[model samples]
Target: MSLKVVVVSWGQLTNVVREVQSQLSGEAQIELVEGLFDQQTTLEMARQIEASGQVDVFVSGGGNARMLRHNLQTPVVAVTVSGYDMLKTILQSRTGDETVYFVHFSEIIHELNDLKEVLPFPVNQVALKTPAEGEAFFNELSRQEQPVVIVGASLAWDLARRHGLKAVYVYTPKAVLEALERAVELARVRRQEMEKTQRVQAILDFACDGIIACDQQGIITAFNPAAEMITGISSQGATGRPVGEVVPSLKLEAVISSDRGLFNQLERIKDKEVMVNKVPVIVRGEPRGAVATLHDIVTIQKAEHQIRLKARREGLEAKTTFAEIVGESQIIQQTIAQARQYARSEATILIMGETGTGKELFAQAIHNASQRQGQPFVAINCAAVPENLLESELFGYEEGAFTGARKSGKLGLFELAHGGTMFLDEIGDISQAIQIKLLRFLQQKEIMRVGGQYTIPVDVRVIAATNRDLLAAVREGTFRADLYYRLNVLPLHLPPLRERKEDIPVLLRDMLFKANRALARYAPVIAREILLHLPAYSWPGNVRELQNIAERIMALALTANLSEHQVQELIGMVLQQGAYEETVKIKAGDLSLRAGERKDDLKKEIGNLEKEVILEALRQTRGNKTRAAALLGVSRSTLWRKLREDIS
Candidate 1:
């Protein structure tokens, strides 16, 4: 990266430049050319050197330097004629009694005016403002009767020598060396500036965002390629034009005037919805200009959607559908049909059922059967994850949000589930603070990350499931009523296994078949005796409990056939002896026992205990329902609700 200096000179000055070049040890590379002022050949030669992109500055004298400066962008240093050069030239060119004529270009050298006091003889000074003027002076010199010694710049001296008159060149070797040094320094500076400009241009060309810059005068200084595409205007056409005239929607003038940045501004620009961000550029406490970055809103959304869907992000999947539910009973079919109808809707769904009742299974089924099947399906169990971690998992967290947070931050399940469904299992287990946030999401369809300063909108259908009665939790001030109502927009209740006994046999077969395929073994079929006795079984865990029994039996597949007692043992383990509970029914406010007379009708027995407790509470509180409810650790409304149910 040596600095290049081009010197256009001839005759004496050319010899001086060669002397300077030979003596120099600096980084500058001097190229000497034989040329004169206002010559087209010399101008073309300089332009070709510049076009090579290797030249930094041009060095010449008088009109030649001015010509290059006017025609080119590279800095041109005009070799200056000092008073010492002029005095030396005059003293050498004249004898003690001869008249001396000195020609200076642009202006008379005022420093030489004081030289008259030091010199023995008076010197006549002539100023030539232009090359034409210098040519006229030389023409007039040719007609003079007396032969006067002429001393002037390179152009003037060349002309004097051409007319066959004695002439002295005014430039010394020191003057040429000084000009070369100045050109080298200036070239270094100009090269640095050019490098900076080139880097900026590279960024403008490669950035994905549309970038436009305006000067303090509201004149567009830069319009990058992306901006050209966005605005349908060329950079060449936009630069130097008033920004308002080029793209008034930019409001660049307003941004500059305000001296404050406006971000995320959604506006219609060039017949397209664009997200614009404008920031005022300030340099040394002064407004230099304003820069704006534009993004097509539709383009941004499409890219995000494509990334969410095509990425098939981790922990986002639903493999179950209605056909996979493995149920044929009327109640189960009706529930599936209703869920199928609900799946077609965009409203929030609240699936209510006990634990081990396939709440999340139904959620996945609904998601698969819905229009958003191909999209993400995110499911999170509210009770399984800790409250703090659940908050971060559900809504995400920013980088450095807390100690040990990931530096890159996190994307929440809500964001991952964008354009799909988010199933919040065990929704009732979420804290009240989370309920507030969930309520906002169900109402506004937006979520704020754990450590985020902004809210991001998510287009996701919500389906919340819970084994706990959310309304009861709401009355107990545990679950938020607003959120409960939001999720209950499309409620789907799953019946327990005891209520849907007809599906037990069907479920048992499906579960065993699945277990067989999974373990690569033969599946054992439960005896008809066990299934017929299943009518007497009170399966608290619904079809999920039936699945447990099937898997247990499949593990004993090599046992040919299980005895009634062995089958009962496995069933007892699955239900924790729930299958042995005697059948009981309420008849006209009377407790009726069908299978046992041991007075173990659990519901009626609990009713009798509850009646005795209520009588005791009434006796202690003088029949004040509020006081009695408070003593029983229940709300007055709950006590009244129980009383109303008893009356009905």
Candidate 2:
């Protein structure tokens, strides 16, 4: 929308409105009218233009400008007499006289003296407080003996002409154009300010939190919709009233005086609990007002609960696949094929493998490849949790079931794994009481919580894993036979590192990259001789042991090429520490030894160490071989060989 301007002019400056219209034609809509500079005429014309709704501002000059500004509500811009206009009038009325009387309003007379040196003739400035006073000054000047030209404002010029005195009017086209430009610029600024106010009001109305603002005098200036709903007060009755009278619960006067802010403070508004924040509105280092915001506490808590649930659900999702197993050996390939076949069925799977054989890795791969891949893949280790807590962890509990039970109860792993896979690691380690309960769950596909009366059904696939032999436990009456057969519906065994020797190089490279990424450092290039020797040594702890050794070697910079003596020292250092010390008992069964001289030499050294350990155990047992075998964590037959001959 363009700015609309109306210019009211006197007859002396007749061409001013036309000049302003021509200059601001495309920029604004100009309205012109001729009228006397009287209060009645100016007020009537201003009201007529405002009633027509065409003008955003008004422009006039001299007495008419002052009258319009005083009596009209719309803005009135007075055409100012610029310094250039004064200079032009002085030159036009110039005579041989050095002293010319310049008369006008008090404000203009002061400006005339600033340009005194720029004029060719000296000027005597006369200031007037009223039109009558200006006419009296000109009438007295007309009686002078000298014929000095009178340079004055429009009012002064009219009085001088009536008295037959020479005069020049000070209003010029340049002055009129300047006034129009200022009025147009002011109109544009006011329009932008109005638009900004509307946008701020809309935001306040739509905000979710309650908002209320008060001036320093404690008068309510703004109350939003949310504030009305929260405080049980209407904006119509609250605005322009004292804040204490509208809402006595909020003490905004305290905030204004302290010039401080309170954040996330708990408050009760209309008997409903809420979190309130009150801050002082500071402008130019002084407090002018205060704003208070309220948020419902119950609503915030519900939002936080939903976020936690979503995070827990996402944490249980499986991110591994068959391709990430990182092995090419035939035994591993056969195990992967069986796992893939099991993924196509919904039967219970029992994976039997030694420790560190990647049982959980295979379980994750099966879940990711199955039809229920998009659902949760929850896992729990029966051996990791205490026996007293395992039953409740699997079946969940009801509210007030125990002294420390949650007020709202909790969902078990089985319930969380509904329509997905639930991997139970170390299944052989559960107590006899839990075994019966697990068997019932497998048979009926339902579970009863620790204190629940009704059974809850779950649609989950079970995958059980164990390093111990379940058949041996069953023979000893430590495990139930029925439970064993139920969990062994689809049995799969994972090969140990000894059986997958050919995949050591591939596993090493993959583990090195993982270590480098995790540690944020680069691994030195491993020597080819070290790679050859790595496959020869027995990794009793399987793939897990190999990964640990690779990380250790990378961290210690053992891969740097060195002399034969240094290589031997490095080998001895790794053997005496790290994975070797943890799995020394199983090295005999897992390692594949070389023939002839090299095999015999390493075997002799290992044999002497074994004998020394046995003798030390026997001394501790006081020469009882059976107790010594138990102390050494080995079978009696293995101990007998160490006492009689070298074990190779």
RMSD of 2: 10.1
Runs off by more than 4 Å, candidate 2: 1-207, 217-219, 225-271, 280-287, 310-316, 346-348, 374-382, 385-422, 430-462, 471-490, 512-538, 552-648
lDDT assessment of candidate 1: 0.77
Cα distance off (Å), candidate 1, residue 635: 33
List per-prediction Cα lDDT, in the order shown: 0.77, 0.77
**lDDT digits (tens) for residues 1-648 of candidate 2:** 778877786656666557545776456877677776455866887898878867788887766778778877778898887777777778878766635778765455567778887776688877677767877787787788778777766666777788888877777777778888888887777667768998989989999888999998989888999988887889999999988888787777689877579999988878989899999989899888899998888877786657755675678877889999988889999999999999999999999987678888999999999999999899987876888889888888888889899876667788888899999998988899999988998999999888888999999999999887899999999899999999999999999887877777677778866666432222222333344445345554577766666665665654445556654556446545433443344344333332233575775656555566667667868999877765554445445545655533
**Residue 285, candidate 1: C-alpha displacement in angstroms:** 3.5
Give the number of the best model, judged by lDDT.
1
Instruction: Name every residue pair that clashes in candidate 2.
Output: none
TM-score of each: 0.49, 0.60
